[model samples]
Target: MTDEMLMMAVKNGDLEKASELFDRYHKPLYNFFVKITFDRDLGHDLTQNVFLRMIKYRASFRQDKQFRPWIYQMARNIYADHFRRNKMLFSDYAEVEDLKNKIAAVDEVMVEDERQKLLYISLFKLQPEQREILILTRFQQMKYEEVAQVLDCSVANVKVKVHRAIKQLREKFLELEKI
Candidate 1:
């Protein structure tokens, strides 16, 4: 069944259908959380919390809306709430050993792994807003319109944010390469 169909079912009190939505979205949502938080355990918790909130707020979902953007909007709000609660700052860089393990395991792609490590390092160095825009648009492969919905901003604003974030990411990546 389509996600919207399933979600609507959930909204209508067919709570069993929520499992289907969870099965479909858990991994993507987990990866989204992990990428932004850099904490897999927190990702798992946050992902679970999303479904819980979905069920709790099911009545708020509108049939006119698309599920993807709706869910992402919830995710962004959850992440922001967590950020505010923690009152923490992003690290300048993740530890090299930790990043190495997170990036790859294949010996044959050692070179590629190095590149990915640098990319993630650069990503972590960005301001949180810049990092989030890049993660939503580039890593999560969300379109500008979808991101605009998730961020509650104009599509044009999303485009501008993405452009500036990419430019900053490229600069950080190049600077990392020199070290």
Candidate 2:
């Protein structure tokens, strides 16, 4: 069944369809979570939490709203919570060091292709929100509407963010001089 049908079933307390939807979306969502968090165990735990949240709130879900956004919102929450906990655990210097490693890993993954490396190198300098907009828009191929939904923002806001991110990315690329 389609997500809509399955969601309706879930809302109506149909255990079977809810189980199917849970199983279907679990892996891809987990992978997305893992890539963003860069922590496998956290991703696994967050994935479980996301599905559990869905199950817990199944009856209250709006039928017109898309499940994808709902799940992505849960992921965003999980990510934010993790970041918060990490911030409290580490001293400023340690957190900076950890971020440096994360940034290096991000660069390695995205810059492997020499041609694309310039693009990512430039983008890396932007604010986190701008960088996130670029990743969700340019790399993920998410439509502005869907992205806005995932981000819990307006479509116009998403567009502005993407446009600015692209402009800044270009500037960064030029500053780096392709080397």
Candidate 3:
């Protein structure tokens, strides 16, 4: 069944349909959280929380709306709220260290690649908003319209944000390469 159909069934109290939606989306959502937070454990927790909220707020699901963007919007809101409540700054020194360690663990050869390492460091150095925009548009391959829905902004604004983010990422990558 389509995600929207599953979600609609879920909204109407067919709780089992929610599991199918979760099964379909959990991996992508987990990856999304990991890319943004750079913490695997936290990503797992946040991903679970997203599904929980999906059920709790099932009635709010609009049948006409696309499910991916709606779920992504929920995840974003949950992540933002958790960040704010914990007073945790994204890309802080400790988190950056964690990200570096995780990257190193994933592949020693990746760490050996100077450009790859620099790109990762530069990506983490970006402001959360910029990093998020890039992750959604570039990494997740979300179209501008879907991203606009997730971000609650116009398509034109998403285009501007993505252009600016790419420019900033290029600048940061160059700066890091110099060091």
Query: Residues 59-172, candidate 3, lDDT per residue (tens digit)?
Result: 999978999999999999989888878887443435566766766643453346766667666776677789899989888899999999999999999999999999999998
lDDT of 3: 0.85
Q: Give lDDT for model 2.
A: 0.72
Which candidate, 1 or 2, has the higher TM-score?
Answer: 1
Misplaced by over 4 Å in model 1 are: 89-112
The residue pairs in collision within model 3 are: none
Best of the candidates, lDDT: 3
Would you estimate the TM-scores of all the predictions? 0.85, 0.72, 0.86
Per-residue lDDT tens digits for candidate 2, residues 1-179, read 67877988988878678788888788767766545554467679988988887888888678788877777777677667766777742112246677677567656653567656566545545665676677677766778898899988899999998889888877888888845
Per-residue C-alpha lDDT of model 1 across residues 46-162, encoded as one tens digit per residue: 999999999999999999999999998898788878776766444323467865654442223323666666777677667778888888888879889999988899999999999
How much is 170 displaced in model 3, in angstroms? 0.5
Name the runs in model 3 displaced over 4 angstroms.
89-115
Candidate 3 versus the native: TM-score? 0.86
- Ranked by lDDT from best down, the candidates are 3, 1, 2
Error of 1 at 125 (Å): 0.5
